[model samples]
Target: MSETTALSSLKIEEVPQKLQIKNYFDLKKYPFEHEALFKREKVTSVIGILNEIEPYAKDWLKNKITSAQKSAYKPEASVISEGSYNVILENGAVFKPAAIIGFSGSKDTHTIYIRKGASVIGANIYLNQGDIYVGEGTVIEPGTAIKGPVILGKNNEIRQGAYFRGNIIIGNNCVIKGELKNVLMMNDCQFPHTCYVGDSVLGYCTHFGNQATSANFGIMGGIISKTITLKIDDKNYDLNRNKIGIIMGDYAQVGCNAVSDPGTFLLPYTIVYSLVRIPKGIYGPNVILKNKSFEKGITEVASLKI
Candidate 1:
């Protein structure tokens, strides 16, 4: 599909009149590569916004890198190699491969491919047991169970005891901590603690606070439904994906013990306070939280807090 058509399919929405594009820009750097692929015409403006955001935008920008990969064609080398240590993409990208060791289950049953420079240590780790592809430069620590059709991009560190199932695509420079489950992390993201991130897509450089979690299902226990889209200027771009978790813009952070409701959209540079239970779209760069009045068991206080 054409770029414009793709963007249009995302159902672009206009920013609130009270909000400024510069504010959004200042909060998070747009993913230039994804912009080039999906919104090239506006890339110049997006880059301008990045310049305006400066140093703070790096993490946000990195998170966007994965989106670019989504639109790019996968090279043949990545598709057919087995147990190869090095993967040379058609574009001449080079990566080191590692060995898949220590599996108690049937090796033939699981098809695990470790690109060059990637390493998987520890025993009882299941691979391709269900269709798993660990990309170049990735490291899977011991005690990890990776279910199939999962794509782990370059330079990712999967810590021990992490159980990831389903269709997960992890991008570059990410760190997956133990005790974490079913998460689709985009580029450069990190979840380094007991975080339950299920059925979600995390943007680049977004970090989850320890114990931070998101609820991806309803009380009835069916698949959670969320709408995916892009917001440019004042338009909403619609992406026709039925299962979506959170569309966190770059550099968004969820504090420890924070719980995000399903279908939440956290704009870049947004910070969720610790132990906060936030609804969808409650997070934005310039959001101000203030307590106007408070009542306590022994006292009452009125305060304006940011």
Candidate 2:
């Protein structure tokens, strides 16, 4: 097989319109060893970034399913399709689904679409509405709630009690369990346990430690202040959106219980230490964001006189 074919196989379909910001992300600075990684992720669109890069969410249930069958979206186990959407299998991977799973769509009815090798384990799970797409080798643990218009890519683990809302796409090889909405995650991302990530786009290999959160709403309640105005070199710029979360690049690790102010943009390899409240700004790449108390800064514990 040609190198291009191999590269394109794992690539998420690209879209136009780069991320709209000056010097926010320098893709050239991404320390990726493989050219394939750059090819898959190198999008410069600033306007509606996810909407432009998101290849799967544009099509409705019917279209996504058909595309999944042809693509590498493989399901190891058999899919017990029992819902409103039609299931079609043509020249594709073999799916010997072990058990007949079901959907309880009383509150929000959804069409569950699972590719070959994907497993939905145990009972007590519910998908409220929209179409659910489970990619190859992915596992949805018991007691998870997924409200649809969502897609899970290859080799992902959606742990127990993970709740999801509409307009979401989880990329390949991710381990995530959280309350989320309108989020797009890239490959090798690990985010689990008690985080509320809303209206955000996380890059490759990003991990959010326990109880960390991206506070999307910058506006204080009851007063009509909604837009997130960012200050760069004393010039304030508007993102032109009310709901904006942390836009973290690849290999960014958020320490436990850290809270990101709205419109926080973290570049690649940024490490935020525990309990650090990241301010709203365009943080350049490879920054170690940590909270330093004034007392700690003033004097060291060992040096201070008792």
Candidate 2 lDDT for residue 85: 33
TM-score for each predicted model, relative to the true structure: 0.56, 0.69
Candidate 1 per-residue lDDT, tens place, 1-306, comes to 423223322222442422222333232343422222223233222212222221222233334332333223232442322331211122332322222322354454433444557775552323433445556777877666665445677888888767675455566888887343334456788887777776554666888878887775544435545544444454454433333355465677778887776556666666776766765443565342222234322111122235
The sequence of per-residue lDDT tens digits that candidate 2 reaches over residues 136-248 is 88888876767667777888888987887767777788899988888878778899787989888887789999999999886583477656655544444555567778887
Per-residue error (Å), model 2, residue 82: 11
Those runs of model 1 whose alpha carbons end farther than 4 Å from true positions after fitting are 1-110, 123-130, 178-183, 221-243, 288-306
Residue 215, model 1: Cα distance from true site in angstroms: 0.5
The candidate scoring highest on TM-score is: 2
- The C-alpha RMSD of each candidate to the native structure, in angstroms, is 11.1, 10.8
In candidate 1, clashing pairs total 25
